[model samples]
Target: MILPFFVYGTLRPGERNHDLFLRGRTLGEEPGRLRGVTLYEGPGYPYAVEEPDGAVSGELVTALPEAYPGLLTALDRLEEYVPGDPRNLYERVVKEVVRDADRAVVRAWVYVAAPAVAARLRARGTPVGGGEWRERR
Candidate 1:
């Protein structure tokens, strides 16, 4: 399914990967929130791990129609996601995110921590408070 992407880490605007990957490819970027996910700090980025009672702040990014294919491939690579790969650090999943503007819930692609990673994080990972990567101390 073709849907907007919910980004919470380096891919968000003003972050390191934004200019390199999404600068000219997105049609729109707006504040959004993904429920039932906890944000955790990675080495230099962040990870969203599924949780029963949590919410993550991010941006819902809509790619330009012509850039969809390439953008999707690039994002997967950036997130180190490989379908069914046990070694993958992240997995691309479809989730509902609420737009900050109008509180409209929309389906979007979300790169979340892979099973093993999520398990590890759940055991000992440091979560970003308030579920906001950018504001993490």
Candidate 2:
């Protein structure tokens, strides 16, 4: 089955990790936006946290059915998301993402900062205004 991902950080197309993990594994990609989330600068990457009136910019990637298992595995490792792990750095969840081209909303998997981590980060993290990770410092 084909799976869709909403990627805002390194896994977005043209980003370093995208070339390494998603370039040939994806069936297609397009700009997407997730509402009620904000982007924050992490040590070397970025993280998304919930916010009342925010919209995070990203890419919606359709995983190739044959390559999806491996691709998803690699992504989980990269994001430090272990299924059922309470200490996971990120948690993969289904969220509604709006396609940039047609503004169509679709459910997609997205890695988001865990609740406690998000609260701490929100307390002091550098917010990327407009929720575009690539455009921030």
Candidate 3:
């Protein structure tokens, strides 16, 4: 549907992956929040796991029309996401994100931890308190 992307962790602005992947490719980036997910620490990154009581702070990134296709593919690769693949680390899904600027609800693509990864994280992964990857300490 070419929806915008909700990025947390290293994909957010000023993060390592931002420059490598999103820089110069997006039309706009703004603060947003994804409800029903918790942020957990992963190897050199962070994963967002579905949790009814949690909310994740991140950015809503709208890619330039021409960049959308490539950006989508690149992100899927970066997140190690393969549709319906059991071994995938993350699964790209569409969700509603609340834009911090206007409190508007926008549908966007979010890469959440895959089923198995989410389960494992739920069992033992360290959650980034406050739901902000950058604020984890």
Candidate 4:
């Protein structure tokens, strides 16, 4: 069975990795919001953290499990995803993102920056909004 993932960052719209990573093979795309999370812009990508009244807007895409590994690698390059390394530009985690008010329980990856990284960007005067821009909706 294929997995459904919700993407809210570079893979959304005009982001750098949009065309390269999500150009074709868009099985399903929808403008949906994930509740109880705060989205933060770290530098190049955005990260979502658990927040009581916050959420992140993005697209829910369904992909084949076999093709997921390569896709993840591509996303890693664009977001600089690194495991066990907080210095990495972006990090991925399995989360539940809502789409069309329907819950799809799947292992979807999201790009997130460390708190320090987000703080630096915020200090520099860039803030990631809770509402995602260029989402599938």
Candidate 5:
């Protein structure tokens, strides 16, 4: 079975790296929100925080199984999503993201960052929102 992942960070569509990752191969993307997580931005990509009362809002992007491996490597090269090291920010893993307005669930891939890294990024005081990634007219 395909695993569920939440793409609250840069992996969401229309971001800086969207064309490199999810442009042609993307199955679909839908507006999704997950509670207990918030956005944290750094000099580059955004991070996700698992706060008790926080929530993360982004898209649910489904990709083909064959394309996922390459996508992972690309993300790793971009955001440096690593396997080990607790302090390492942006760990790519399967996460449950809401589909169809919380009524249905689907398998997706998400990159979650460590809280410490997120905290540091927050301290830097950068704007946090998916809109910032978009090109303004």
Candidate 6:
């Protein structure tokens, strides 16, 4: 079955990792956003953390049924997420994404940093006020 995913950083279209991980594997893509989160720039990519009223802009993509299995594996590796791992680089979670085109909301999987990691990134990494990785890059 097809699976929906919310990608905010390198996994987004045109980013370095997109072709390697998503490209032909996706059935559809739409501009989307997640509220209550702030985006911060890392060395060559960006990551998001929850915030009081912050909003992060990203893309909502549907994985093709045929590619779903491999896609999920690759994405989990890319995000450095191991099931039940407390020290994961990012936690994969289901969240509501607001489509930018019509303000429609859809449930999708998103990777979010832990609060401590967020705090560290906020203090050390550059804050992307617009909450968009593509725009900042």
The CA-based lDDT of model 3 is what? 0.95
Off by over 4 Å in 4: 1-3, 13-16, 41-45, 101-107, 118-130, 135-137
Error of 5 at 2 (Å): 4.0
lDDT of 2 by residue, 53-109 (tens): 888999999988988999889999999899889898789999999999998999999
Q: What residue runs in model 2 are displaced by over 4 Å at the alpha carbon?
A: none
State the lDDT at 81 in candidate 6: 89
For residue 123, give model 2's deviation from the true position in Å. 1.3
Pairs with backbone N, CA or C atoms under 3 Å apart (clashes), candidate 5: 4-107, 4-108, 5-108, 5-109, 36-54, 37-54, 37-55
TM-score of 6: 0.91
Candidate lDDT scores, in order, read 0.95, 0.89, 0.95, 0.64, 0.63, 0.85
**lDDT (Cα) of model 1:** 0.95
Error of 5 at 115 (Å): 3.9
Cα deviation of 22, candidate 5, in Å: 1.1
User: In model 5, which range of ten residues has the least summed lDDT?
Assistant: 128-137
Q: Kindly give the stretch of ten consecutive residues in candidate 4 with the minimal lDDT sum.
A: 121-130
Q: Over all chains combined, what TM-score does candidate 4 have?
A: 0.72
Per-residue lDDT of candidate 1, residues 1-137 (tens digit):
79999999999888999999999899999999999999999999999999989899999999999999999999999998889999999999999999999999999999999999999999999999999988985
lDDT of 5 by residue, 32-129 (tens): 76655656665566666655655667787766677766766676667666678675666666666667576576546667666677667656745455
Superposed on all Cα atoms, model 6 deviates from the true structure by an RMSD in Å of 1.7
Better of 5 and 6 by TM-score: 6
Q: How much is the lDDT of residue 21 in candidate 5?
A: 73
Q: Model 4 over residues 96-118: C-alpha lDDT tens digits?
A: 66666566444555665556665
* Residue 87 local lDDT, model 4: 81
Error of 3 at 51 (Å): 0.4
Q: State the lDDT of candidate 6 residue by residue for 1-137, as single tens digits.
A: 24499999998888889899988998888999998788988778778887768889889989888889899999999888898887886888888889999998888888998656787886787778688887884
TM-score per candidate, chains pooled: 0.98, 0.95, 0.98, 0.72, 0.73, 0.91
